[model samples]
Target: MIRSGNPALKESTFLDLGTGAVVSRNAGAMTLNGTVNRTGILLLLCVLTATYTWNTALTPTGELAPGALLYILGGAIGGFILAMVTIFKKTWAPVTAPLYALAEGLFLGAISAMYEVKFNGIVLQAVLLTFGTLFALLMAYRSGWIKATENFKLGVVAATGGIALIYLATIVLGFFNINIPYIHESGLIGIAFSLFVVVVAALNLVLDFDFIETGVEQNAPKYMEWYAAFGLMVTLVWLYIEFLRLLSKLQSRN
Candidate 1:
């Protein structure tokens, strides 16, 4: 009954795919250290790919390099596909997770570079804020300062779902030549909305931490280390994007 607001780390994430069985202790079970180490590996892979894409997407002249959009689109689609595959086939996470990280890196790298062109120093600011929030929340959660109570989870899940619906509506409306006002603007309303979203996104990391500890306690299979890492990466990516959006909104106000 492990629950998380992150869609990737849903309830029953560590349960056997079809057997409805719990992992045995001798089955090379998931460990906190192992998951943490694998998370580092995935982060390294993501950073490597992101750096490459950033270099390739932005030329020395500060203009976009050719095929930049391809990197973005390819990464977006490819990362989505790989993530779905990994979710449905958890055993394949040892392979698909790394691929997913690389693809997402490409997508994020290109997007961040473009943002840098419009708002110099924004990318670094976003990265710092993202990781800073991560550490701060982790410390808070580990020290019992923040607990993922049922009410907290429900609130975060509801907020996340609302945000998803808003994004979906925005996309659907775009098809009809309609644009949502204020939400995407740099005005006070937009900034407030972005700040709220950022807080929710950061709160998700708390759920992620609680969820992963539950997985380890359940003795999820060793391969689940990769799956767990993937789930955490998904949250981290979302958080980083929200920070970017929030920072961009604030910068635009200047």
Candidate 2:
């Protein structure tokens, strides 16, 4: 018998969607493996982004030209599409991974061009620093020096989410010709916030590592490589941006 208005009813009996009990369990397990492959796919995306950004920033005309805006716009649109595909298409990893990489490359290229012009050699410095931080974090994770407990992971996620919200709000405020004064000129507070964001980004790598280990142990499906790579790419990209911004803020203070 079924009961009405019951939120805790046996979901299997009502919404099983015809998948047998055994298959459902198997599918649930595969999800663990999928996470591993996603990290690998993300690394490939990082390579693509780096290549594009390097070429754009190192060009003869470089950041001085107006043509770079087109690339930025294209990258933005492509990134949105990539996010949609990743979230909605379970089977789209293989196809969408490369596309996301290309789009991210275009976007990074234009942004890097501007930074390169402003800071003069800041691009390479940020790149080297970003990779160094990544390597150090990887070593720490492998050695079990910084275990990401549930609370740690939750805290990072919350902080990252808050940082994202602030960025979005800043973007929206820009349309009204208003800016967050502190983020640009509040001296110690701005530096402190940037430091916090960098820490949060580093912490995300721990979660990524945990996800990869879980996937490998669970023997995730083959397509999961793309998914894992995608996940890593997302984290690395965020980390790199934070690093670059931190450097810029520090340099400005000096």
- The numbered model that scores best in lDDT is 1
For candidate 1, what is the lDDT? 0.91
Q: How do the residues 1-254 of candidate 1 rate in per-residue lDDT, one tens digit apiece?
A: 45677888988788877686768889789999999999999999999999999999998999878788898899999999999999989999999999999999999999888888889999999999999998999999999999999989999989999999999999999999999999999999999999999999999999999999988999888898999999999999999998899899999988
Local distance difference test, each candidate? 0.91, 0.66
Compose the digit string of candidate 2's lDDT tens values, residues 103-210. Answer: 887777677777777777877887897789888988998898988676776676678778878999999999999999886553898888888888887777777766
For each candidate, what TM-score against the reference?
Answer: 0.97, 0.80
Q: What range of 10 consecutive residues in model 1 has the weakest lDDT sum?
A: 16-25
